[model samples]
Target: MECVGVRFAHSPKIYDYRFGSQAPPVGSWVVVKTPRGLELAKVRTEPRLGQAVGEIVRVATPADLDQHSKLKNRAEEVYWWLKARLRREGVRAKLLGCEFTLDGNHISVQYSAEQRIDLRRWVSELNRLAGARVEFVALGPRDQTAYLGTLGACGMESCCSNWLQDFTQVSIKMARDQQLPLSPEKISGPCGRLLCCLQYEHQQYQELLAELPRKNSKACSLQGVCGKVAKLNPLAGTVDLVTEEGSTVTVHKSELRWE
Candidate 1:
């Protein structure tokens, strides 16, 4: 009933495999039979009884790792080769990354494009060169971010690469709720979509926003203005108010009362 959580090579997503007859240690590299093919994946967490997406094939030996590396070494070559062919064949797509199974029986590609591409010829050429089944998977904004990981604007490894297993729909409202810069470069991650991290404190922001009075609502302030609440800072517990004389003043939340 136990299962092993496994991640394949720098991917943030993890899949569970039936422990079956093997109990690999955390961080151990093990061969697993994923739906894609035989892949060598790392044991990502402590084993537990859980549903599994696939089953462990065996503990990956040094030989297995060496072969896996050899196949991976061909990634750049395969990438360039496909890029050239796609161009020659007038296939319009941006190739993001390529993955090879541990057994070198299959190669999966991630790409993006504005329109659907006819890939039968492309796949055949790849299958002939790599001697494996070729899979071309379309990637979304989040998938593009994961395939080619990058440092985020926060100056750290992006969350998607480090630990994000799945992406949630991000909205402009989340950015507005957090008072983030509305600029595209500032609000969007390396993925060119709203940063996935924005949702981390979204619920809290929504709760806090609800607790505070809205703009232009009448509120009592220590400044003795009593005109209207202009802005609210939930984290700082401060509010900005406009006075009857049209002067704006800031006051702590403790000094304000809303009807």
Candidate 2:
């Protein structure tokens, strides 16, 4: 026999099902048994590398699909109710989204807030109406992108939703690398997290930096001795040269007309 579990994305939940002889193929949606009830979820990855401890079970039924769809809609409705209720309560926060397990056993609400919130009472009330085990998870900006994502400045789907598995910390130094302006509003996303793409190319820029001379190296030019590489201003393509003789001059990196 084999034991398999349905992996739920965007939430830390899983539905373990018994597979007697065979296992559901990867990425396939299956109905699994849980403490609360049966639920539907896609198999993200194949169950461990080996065969089952028991026999494989049957795939999901048509009725299971129908119930899954209904549960999803109901979860969305519950999310809206929470959103409206929170707004009425004067809590200004973002409702990232909600996820309902296929078994109808569990639901998770993802939210982004400025600070801590006491949603215990509200969550209990929701469970009474939802008639299921409810889990409220507080999501940060990066987690928000993982749950409820949108397009980025590059006009494509968010990296967090599509490819980024882990969220790496982002800082202002990254903005300075590609010559981006130091404006936080321009560099940050709606989630207020650093752009995911920053981590992608930082190494390339760092590698390219090795070939370039330091900004403080003195330049011995025919016109005079310059104190340091004042700037590699791309727009000007010039390094502002400060002279040992108390003079400042600009020289192009390509055209060292200084000679």
Instruction: Name the candidate that leads on TM-score.
Output: 1
Number of the predicted model whose lDDT against the real structure is largest: 1
What TM-score against the true fold does each predicted structure earn?
Answer: 0.92, 0.72
lDDT of each: 0.84, 0.68
Supply every candidate's count of residue pairs whose N, Cα or C atoms clash at under 3 angstroms: 0, 20
Clashing pairs for model 1 are: none
- Tens-place lDDT per residue, model 1, 28-143, is 98988877788888898888888888888888899998998898888768988988888887788998878898878889888898787766666777888888889888987777
Candidate 1 overall Cα lDDT vs. reference? 0.84
